[model samples]
Target: MSKAAFTSDSLESTFLAYTRVLSQYREYWDFLPFAQFDSGWSEPKVAHAMAQLTETDIEHFERDATALYQQMVVLFPEVKMLPVPELRTQTRPEVPFWLHTGIGGRKLTQIQAFVATLPTHATHSPQHENVLEWCAGKGYLGRFLAFTRNSCVTSVEIEARLCEQGLAAAQKFSLSQRFLRANVLSESATIPFSMNDRAVALHACGGLHTTLMTESVAHAIQAVHIAPCCYHLHGEGQYRPMSHVGRANDLGLSREALKFSVQGMVTGGDRIARLRQQELSWRLSYDSWRQVHTKDHLYRPLPSAPKSLFQGDFATFAQWAAQQHGLTIADTEQWQPYLAQGHKLSVQVRRIELIRHVFRRVLETWLVLDRALYLHEAGYKVQVELFCDYQVTPRNMMIHAHYLS
Candidate 1:
């Protein structure tokens, strides 16, 4: 794999490149690093290279994925080049004070970035007269589009509470916006999409966004603008490809693999980071201890613990976790070494994950391209590009498509 920019290539060519490379090395990024302590590298030299990484090296790799990815080219030359596109950001619109009122800083930023790519009130043509905001939470996006674009807006959301709030806000603002409460996934859900409507969704997760495209295609809607998130939240645990090329290639994406694609997003502040590290250390220690006693040598998932569990130390958390799983722990005195061992394992796991993290964007690109190619196959002219800067949101890939006619 030499350096090749997929952005300059055709969708089919880019898809083929990713498929060939990913198929060749499916063993690397397709598995969970935390599930087992084994690095699973066939080459002893690769294993030795990983073992040589210190905590500082691990931290550096985790923080800067690009640097790590470039370094990985030395070991895995087959993946020397990737088909990741250079993402482009849309020019943001000047939002009114009224529009910015209740929205959080991040949400407002994302909404502005998303809305910027859409047709404004002055630019709305006869073919794209109305707006349909799918999975509208409180209809903030719908209201923004209605006010800025002056389109007849229909905000469809599952939650009655959000619909009511959105309706109230629309009325207060005197905007031509209506909120409809209906589940997008339900067969009986009435969607008010007309041929002249341009459907938009900011960050509809998994099947929610998929449903948007399916419904839009079925109704022959004028256009669709969407930024998809949460690739693993599909109703079915597995990801079947949408395009003919994708279906033919058949990447065999499990739910775990889908989840792995989006796991590289930045976490919250220092407190959250510390708490996460603490939890990881405890969980790994327990797994290591359990494997020794039970001789199963497999990862056993524990139920999500309460935040309050973290206020106490590792031993207390382990006790609660063990009781939940019908397992017993050794004496508290014996736990000290295991706690240290867990920390050591945590560093090792993080190092292992650094290699896997390089493919995070690659997997996401494949998924996004699958959707884009699906639209293209359905007689639509589709453009897949970044709607916002990656710093604002890693899930910034937007699919903007319109009927070929």
Candidate 2:
């Protein structure tokens, strides 16, 4: 409920608070739901209460994280004292009428909100006269910025076709924009960032955004505006904290743990939910059957199958999955019992995930705040805000920083 923007000290305090709470309550969110059958609750009353959770309760928690948190507070009285910081919302951007051709409704809205949330052209110093758009897809955001601002935009993208399309659009509008087709991760990609450049990335994946941050700081870029996504997509196998504070309070985030941060169900509707449920149920069923056949209780992860596979019966999906692991489904195998068992396991997993899902945003906040603290440590005035509603995109949080030195 606090409207005050996060300063360096405040950001550190909030980050530390989340770290402490997560560390304290690691039992709830620190494990994979499918990997373990046990509820793992130490409190007898809390365990009894959670064990009684029905499908409806799981569905409710799936939709609303705050509701789950409130319920958790009621169940575990000690967690009521946990310090949870609320991110301040930014003013909604006014979307001007422009030829927003080919852009989807969701994407256009995200671009508008992102652009308006940034500092205006008048607010930029002479050093921030130029803009570098990292991983720009067709340079839509860069083109929009060029249309609205006086800054020359350099859009960097890995794909040549996208760069060509973006370049064509920029040329058509006679905007001060150009596209560079180069892998931002490659050491020899030859990016043209300078001290006068203000780096901007919209929904850049893990390594891409991290590259922008490191490159910007190294080049002494005047400013950086980034909304990062896909925390698990980084090239590095494990997470390495960027800021000193984060390193000091390291949660030892694994790839699976990072993936858990983005498993929120905000935009997906009933069909998506149904598909997800079917997929999980089938996968769990296969795992259950495999455990008995091999006499091994350890969890074995299956490679991701196509949506078409889920459309078929569990028998078909299991056969396909089994083939990949050099196993065969015997003709006499009773799939119905395993399927029933899978459904039961599915419910159990979902109930366990209900409590774990509450920390998705908290983990996300820790991530972005770590980036902000890194900028703060590098002598930048950093600010983090929710640029749009969670419904628009769960990855709506933005970090804006400018060199003060």
Write the residue-wise lDDT of candidate 1 on 9-127 in tens digits: 37777877778877776766888657756777776777888888887887667666668878775776655655455455456777679866889988888888888876555745454
Q: Least lDDT summed over 10 consecutive residues: which range in candidate 2?
A: 77-86
Candidate lDDT scores, in order, read: 0.78, 0.80
Per residue, candidate 2 scores C-alpha lDDT tens digits across 1-405 of 234466666888877877887787788787865787677677687678778888888877777877887776566443454343334544544434554678888888788888887776753445336889999989988987777665689999999999999999888878889888899999424888872458899999998898889888888788899998998888667788899999999999988888988877533788778898899899989988998998888879888889999997778899998998789889778888888898998888887787677667768878888999999998888888877776778788888899986
Which 10 successive residues of model 1 have the least lDDT summed? Answer: 1-10
- lDDT, residue 55, model 1: 76
* lDDT of prediction 1: 0.78
Number of backbone collisions per candidate: 0, 0
Clashing pairs in 2: none
Report lDDT (Cα) of residue 366, candidate 1. Answer: 88
